[model samples]
Target: MAEHNLGDSHQVFDGEGKTFTINDKHVAIFNINGDLFAFEDACKHMGGSLGKGKLEGNLVACPNHGWQYDVTNGKCVTENECESGCRVDTFPVKTENNEIILSLPE
Candidate 1:
């Protein structure tokens, strides 16, 4: 278990950008404009790392099976074979001193 600090939330744009030390458990953090959001980086359909996927608007499309998820809400849009309750765990992000702090429970 480890803690990492990502700089100001406003530095990222709407694409496959990464935050410092924000990669773990196949999860990754991304910023849309100045809003921060985190998602299970692995795609539910094929275990694809979404951090390397393409970001279309607020949605991140899985590179493996083309499964798309709404980065803002983690909503699957590919209509894959995942169970209705299947969903990625969303992280709670806070900003302080112009920096984005992600709190993960160990």
Candidate 2:
């Protein structure tokens, strides 16, 4: 596993999400009620950017087709119309020294 430092945690507001490209992967980071969650930026349904989607509580709605996913576990909350398992890849995230760190597969 590799740890990528995503900037200060303060940069991400509560109920909002951010995107970062690390090692050629688009990672989405979310701040939900002061906690952090990280996952693949692409939606499982149609490759929509989850970071650009709307966040409601722990759920994020894909901007392309309204597919909702839980930022906490990357599980699809809405209908699973995706033939290819409707779950986004989730990453381990933590806050250390005020910085958001994401652990990605090496």
Candidate 3:
């Protein structure tokens, strides 16, 4: 596992998300109720940018096609169901001294 420091935690406010490009990987980091969750930024159905999606609780709706994903676990919740083979990759996230840290599989 490789870790990358993503600057201050305050950069991502509660109920919001931000995208970062680390090691050539596009990742979206979300702050939900002061907790952080990281995952791939691309939507599975149409390659929409999840970082720019609309957040509703733990789920984010894709701005392009309305596909929804649970930011907490990277599960596709479109149509109130977890579609098989329609999940995004998730990463480990942490915060230290106001700095957001993310882990990526190597």
Candidate 4:
């Protein structure tokens, strides 16, 4: 596993659920209220980048097809729309003294 310091917690507070690239992978780092979230940048439906999607609390809509996902549990919330059971890859995030960091899996 590897660890990388992203930046200050405040830097991402206004840009939560926005997509960005990290370690050759697209990552969307966000802060909900005071909690931190990290997920794969792409949407399961059409490879749309989640950064361009709209945020609805902990859920975000895919820019390509309007698919929704809850970042905390990586689950789909669209009604009666049997999905492929895809989920955004999530990473553990932490804030220490306002410094943000990602705990990447090995």
Best by TM-score: 3
Rank all candidate structures by their lDDT, best first, as comma-separated numbers.
3, 2, 4, 1
Q: What would the per-residue lDDT of candidate 1 be over residues 72-96, giving only the tens digit for each residue?
A: 8787877646667666777777678
Off by over 4 Å in 2: 83-85
Cα RMSD for candidates in order: 2.9, 1.5, 1.6, 1.9
Model 3 clash pairs are none
Candidate 2 positional error at 8, Å: 1.0
lDDT of 3 by residue, 1-106 (tens): 9988989899999999999999889999999999999999999887899999999999999899899999988989887554686789999999999999899998
Rank the models by TM-score, top first.
Answer: 3, 2, 4, 1
Per-residue C-alpha lDDT of model 4 across residues 59-81, encoded as one tens digit per residue: 88888889888878677787666
- In model 4, the clashing pairs are 1-106, 19-51
On a 0 to 1 TM-score scale, where does candidate 1 land against the true structure?
A: 0.76
Pitting candidate 2 against candidate 3, the one with the higher TM-score is 3
User: Once superposed on the true structure, which residue ranges of model 3 sit more than 4 Å away at CA?
Assistant: 80-82
lDDT against the true structure, per candidate, is 0.71, 0.89, 0.92, 0.77
Model 2 over residues 1-106: C-alpha lDDT tens digits? Answer: 9988887999988888889999799998999888999999998777999999999878999999999988988988785465545689999999999999999999
Residue 29, candidate 1: how far off, in angstroms?
1.5
Model 2 C-alpha lDDT versus the unseen true structure: 0.89
lDDT-wise, the better of 2 and 4 is: 2
Model 1 CA RMSD to the hidden true structure, in angstroms = 2.9
